[model samples]
Target: MPSGESGHALKVESWGDPSILVTEFPDIEDFHGQLIETVLRLEQDPEFTRHFDGHVGESKVYHVERWDCPAARLIDARAKALFTSALKKENAVVDLSWASVYRAGNYCLPHSHFRSAASLVYFLDLGDEEAGGRFLFTDPRLKICCRHEPGRMTYPVGPQVRPGILMMFPAQCVHMVTPYHGTRPRITMSWNIDDKALPGNPLPN
Candidate 1:
């Protein structure tokens, strides 16, 4: 939360897997303002549709790749710091980055990112508190339980729906979003980092 510092880390309860990390940042680097503004501007831009895809018309998967995220530089540095600190991967570079706007009825299907060591989702804006739009992740233990398990998480799904929150996990983890019925739109930015991208003293690299 200091100068040149990234966001404040939040605790992510872990299970047996040590390669897992679920960190929450408290907007320590001031990336939230820029992140939200970029999406808002894109929504009004005539060509916004051309630069992004997913949930464009009939589709519901939001993805923007032609232009890097507005806060790419800051995100890159902070993300590297966090990833290396959590996963011990250094010299990390963002291989892919994009922004998405989720309006009413928009939802993402279950999927995992490919060709990357980790995947991150930064919550730029959460439209409504009652819209019931929640981030869902598959159980890491491969459980198919429809009910809660004892001495552990009972549900097979995990949810995190909050603004100014950044969620990171293994690239191979499957996740999705529930339908957003809120009147206001939800904005978010996501990216993946390749293990091969990091190869030096992360700070100077």
Candidate 2:
């Protein structure tokens, strides 16, 4: 993919009722390498804590406010831009930012982010395409699942997973990841954001 003068190529696509924004950053090899290394190093640090909840299975996810890495900041800027463009709202701020590292047998259950106007997931390293860690979004309506035929309703549709692809959707959209079976780890970064700054959660500097 040919990049712009700034060496950053972006392509944005939006769909669905609430609108899901899928942005492709096709030229960021160096930035991705730096970010992957940074996250791996942090994982090995004894002081860096990992978080787990009922929604995740054997995966490492943690919040970070002080991660001032240039690659991360670049992602933040792009996310804010996409948010504003899609929602026609300005001064959007990231309420929470986190990184997720998933090994074999790791997955996330269907859930939605609360208190957020929107949320995004950036695919850093999707290990194996056939290893079955596809991201899925369930239809919010209960009537969709009642159909007897399988192909009739496309409720749990997902985008093609690839590196440097960022997907932003409404906060209420319930999404999840299937169990991964690849030998290599699957890595991703996420953010919970709103149109404006929240009371206690401030934007990253």
Candidate 3:
């Protein structure tokens, strides 16, 4: 833990903890609108929600490539810069993209992307209020012992995640979302990054 971020307070500091990070810009819209459309479609699939705990609508497979859509282009370019800088690499490459949409009472189970170096989640709507869906990341160091008492041991300590927030964290860190109780569905874009993905080449694990 770095400086005053460790103890019992819920502060969103870098802390030099390679396992988590959060960036925010709540106003940027998904220009191509595929994210919104995808969320709506996925919500109708019964098989999808049960298959992956309310997750569906995975982005098309691409070879570390960028799409013509403005939002895709932004994620491709800006995300690459963010990943490369965070991982201290010159050619960080995104492996693939996926999405999830959660309605009232839907949620994801705690899990980790153990195969990837880093992972990212771009939120469209983080639910309506604190009563709705809340993204949580268990501290890997003390996940087993951590408590979820409000104003005491905020089990998942994270930054204020509004729309357009791009959250990046170590792929091996355990995280999950609390059940959403909002009227609207919660939408997000998730992708893994590989620092070994050189230009014009497949990513190396």
Highest TM-score against the true fold, candidate? 2
State model 3's lDDT: 0.57
| Steric overlap count per candidate | 3, 0, 0
Query: Residue by residue across 1-205, what tens digits does model 2's lDDT show?
Result: 2233386656677644337788778666868888887777777654553645424644344455456577766776777777777678866777887778887878888878867799988899998779977888775442333254643444576777689888888877788898888888788888888977678533232
Per-residue alpha-carbon lDDT of candidate 3 for residues 1-205, written as tens digits (9 for 90 to 100): 1011123322232422545665554336535266465445544554332234353222222321433344555555655666766557777766665556666777766777645688887777665677556777765454332554423434564455777667778777777777777876667767788876534432223
Q: For residue 163, give model 3's deviation from the true position in Å.
A: 0.7
lDDT winner among the candidates?
A: 2
Model 1 over residues 71-174: C-alpha lDDT tens digits?
A: 64565565566666666665566666656677787777776776678887777677788785577765444343234563343453654556655667787877
Give the RMSD in angstroms, all C-alphas superposed, for model 1: 6.7
Q: Could you tell me the lDDT of residue 166 within candidate 2?
A: 84
Q: What's the TM-score of every candidate structure? A: 0.69, 0.81, 0.67
lDDT of 3 at 38: 42
Q: Against the hidden true structure, what lDDT does model 1 obtain?
A: 0.59
Which stretches of candidate 2 lie above 4 Å from their native place? 1-9, 15-18, 46-48, 53-65, 141-155, 200-205
Report the number of backbone clashes for model 1.
Answer: 3
- Residue 179 displacement (Å), model 3: 0.5
